[model samples]
Target: MPRNRQILLDNRPHGEASTTNFRLIAEDTPPLRDGQVLVRHHFLSLDPYMRGRMNEGKSYAQPQPLGQVMIGGTVGEVVESRHPKYQPGDKVQGMGGWQEYSVVDAGQPGALRKVDTTHVPISHYLGAVGMPGVTAWYGLVKIIDPKPGQTVVVSAASGAVGSAVGVLAKARGARAVGVAGGPAKCRYVTDELGFDACVDYKQHRDATSLAGALKEACPGGVDGYFENVGGLVLDAVMLRANAFARIAMCGMIAGYEGHPIPMQHPQLILTNRMRVEGFIVSEHLEVWPDALKELGELVGSGKLRPRETIARGLESAPEAFLGMLRGRNFGKQLVQLV
Candidate 1:
């Protein structure tokens, strides 16, 4: 039997998660069942949503119970297999979590995808080619629904989901405007990704003053908004949206630390007849093929680029996770375990 190192829930966070709220442990693996596969993690995807799971409160995904292995997305290689469908040495993507190894049932809902990394990095399967990619695709096409010549805006513009929205919007003939934290991210959004404009939110005197900068960036008024950080940022964008504007409400990284939700100008929504809708990409999985095909085509043609911040080793997951929440990462945050 082999020993697996895993991170487990120790305490529920009050607001932002802390290192003390988790525990590291070593466990001996049991004999593989007839229909199971032993997987050694190669990479772990650290995302903003994991912070919600650290709390005992309700959320889109179930909360991680005390003493259970912390939940997350994993890209792993099969070390042993009792299932006929999977063979040893094959790669997969699934919710194997923050651990060195995982014993997964072949028919489980979170099965890993077999990938070939000759053309691209395998970590992408957990990033732009996987869940984050899917999330960006669905959120933009389905939720925001930017039309040709429309002014499209994305918050957290340098991130996986936000950056994808900007690129896709531009490709679809919409004017893409990105809002990021600093000059570096702003330059990446406009110069690198070809956004029409980018507003450096970090340079604003305060979140309250972001609306002025955002208004200047979108003189035509925003038609489609791909939201990532909520609270003040959302309020700012909401104030600048044109009549009949559309908003795709994704993760609210800003408010994840339990900040008070800012009050919005509700009268503008009524007068402008704008629409704000929230969606989970998982709920729209059936529509992914079309979006994925388009995104893949863009990637293949070198139009869309995905940047990733890699943290080596599983033990680095904690710091990587914290860094994402703090906006210290340039792109999708991943912990490479292999």
Candidate 2:
């Protein structure tokens, strides 16, 4: 048995989450039972949705229980296994949480999935080619459904999900426009990610000001929208939206910390005749194979070059997660546990 390092949710957040909310502990790994596998995690994914889970209230998912290992996505290698289906040295991805190791019941469906890391890096199984990529695919392809020459807009455009949304939209022959916080991020959204144009949301103090910038970037009114950061960005997008525009409600990161994100014009949806749909990607399991197939092809062909910002060691997960919440991380934020 090996020593396993885990970060548990020490307490629920009163307002904003801090490092104090999590506590790190070390324990000896228990011997695996029949149909079980032990994985030494290499990477742990930090995502915005995890913030909502930390709260003790009704949400799309269950709250992160106090004094329990914080839930998250992980990619690792099987070091020991009693399961007949799995062998040592197999790379696998699962909900391994914020830990350096995981004991998985291999008999459970979707508990441990073997991954091919020959072309795609194993860490990417937690990012672009995994949940985030599938999220982008569902929001863009299934909800927004942009047509050729139509303009599609996404907020938080440099982040993992938003970056993929813009690139995926461009592949559909639609013009991709991005709204990011800083000039550097905006530049990366346009220059690196190939968005048709990008607006620096930090420059605009209000929705009207942001709407002016969006109008310049999206000469053609926004035909579709991928909402990641709600608040003013959503308002701005609505102001510039064309008739019958579709809006994919993915996340409202702006209001994640118990803040109210009121829409300036609630009547815009009716006036613009827009179709706004909120979705949880997990509920759409039927689409994963097709979505992963297309996303995997994009990554393999170098069409989707997703960037990552990794923090070293298990102890850094809390601070790295906080940085991501504040939009301080450059791209996909991960903890390198190995």
Candidate 3:
């Protein structure tokens, strides 16, 4: 039997998740039964949702079971398969967890799907053409449905979902404006991603400053917003939004860690008649097919450029994940495991 290495959630963190909360387990993998595929993970995705999974609370998704394999999406290659459908060397994607290998049960519906890495990179199955891409698509197309000449504001604009939101909005002929942390990220959000403007939030910590920057960027008033950061930025956006503005509340990174974040102007949600909706991407599987096709075409045509901060080796998953929590990485954060 070949030994399999896995990362388990050792303990729930006190405030922020630390490497201390994760344990690496090395054990021999048992033989696969019928309808089983031995998948060797090549890349593991570290997303903000994982932070919520680390907490013990009421959430859209179940809290990650304690002292178990840490849950995550993985892009892998099927090295061995007992299932009639799967074959060796078939590139696959699944909820393969944070491990070097996973024995996926093919009997379970949607357990895995074959990936085409010839034109599209396999790592993208975890990013641009994957969950984050579809997340942006759903929020943009279904929720905030912006029109040409309208202004769409995006928070955490340098990140995976936010970047995608800005680009797709621009592609749809909407004027896209971004709110990012630093000058460099803001530059990338505008210069590289082709957003109309990017407000560097770190430069303006106070409401007055943030509002002023947003005003300068969106002179006509914000018509739509794709929220990802969700603290003071949400407050600013709400205050600046036009009448009947629509906002898609994605991830609230500010409150992800057990911390108190005050929203200065939540009252605008009612006064402006804004349509604010929160969504969990996993719940809406119906739109993935169309969304993925559009995302793939966008990425394939070199129109959508999704950046990633790649960390080598499975051992780096913990540190890389922690770094992402602190806003240390730009775009999507992924760990490559061979």
Q: How many residue pairs clash in each candidate?
A: 2, 0, 0
Q: lDDT tens string, model 1, 1-338?
A: 58988988888888778888888999997899999999998888898988887877668878888998889888878999999989998888788989999998887654656766656567877767778888888888887788898899999999888888889888888999999988999989988889999998877765558999888888999998988898777888888989999888888887787776765776778888988888888788697678767766666676778888999977788888888999999988998887
Q: What is the C-alpha lDDT of each candidate?
A: 0.84, 0.94, 0.91
Q: Which parts of model 1 are misplaced by more than 4 Å?
A: none
C-alpha RMSD of each candidate structure in angstroms: 1.6, 0.7, 1.0
Give the C-alpha miss distance for residue 60 in model 3, angstroms. 1.0
Give the alpha carbon lDDT tens digit for every residue of 1-338 in model 2. 89999999999999999999999999998999999999999999999999999999999999999999999999999999999999999999999999999999999988999999999999888888999999999999999998999999999899899989998999999999999989899889988889999999999999999999989998889999999999999999999999999999999999999999999987999998999999999999899999888888888988888889999999999999999999999889999988
For every model shown, what is its TM-score relative to the native structure? Answer: 0.95, 0.99, 0.98
User: Residue pairs in steric clash, candidate 3?
Assistant: none
Query: Which ranges in model 2 have alpha carbons more than 4 Å from their true place?
Result: none
Clashing pairs in 1: 93-112, 93-113
lDDT of 1: 0.84
The candidate maximizing TM-score is 2
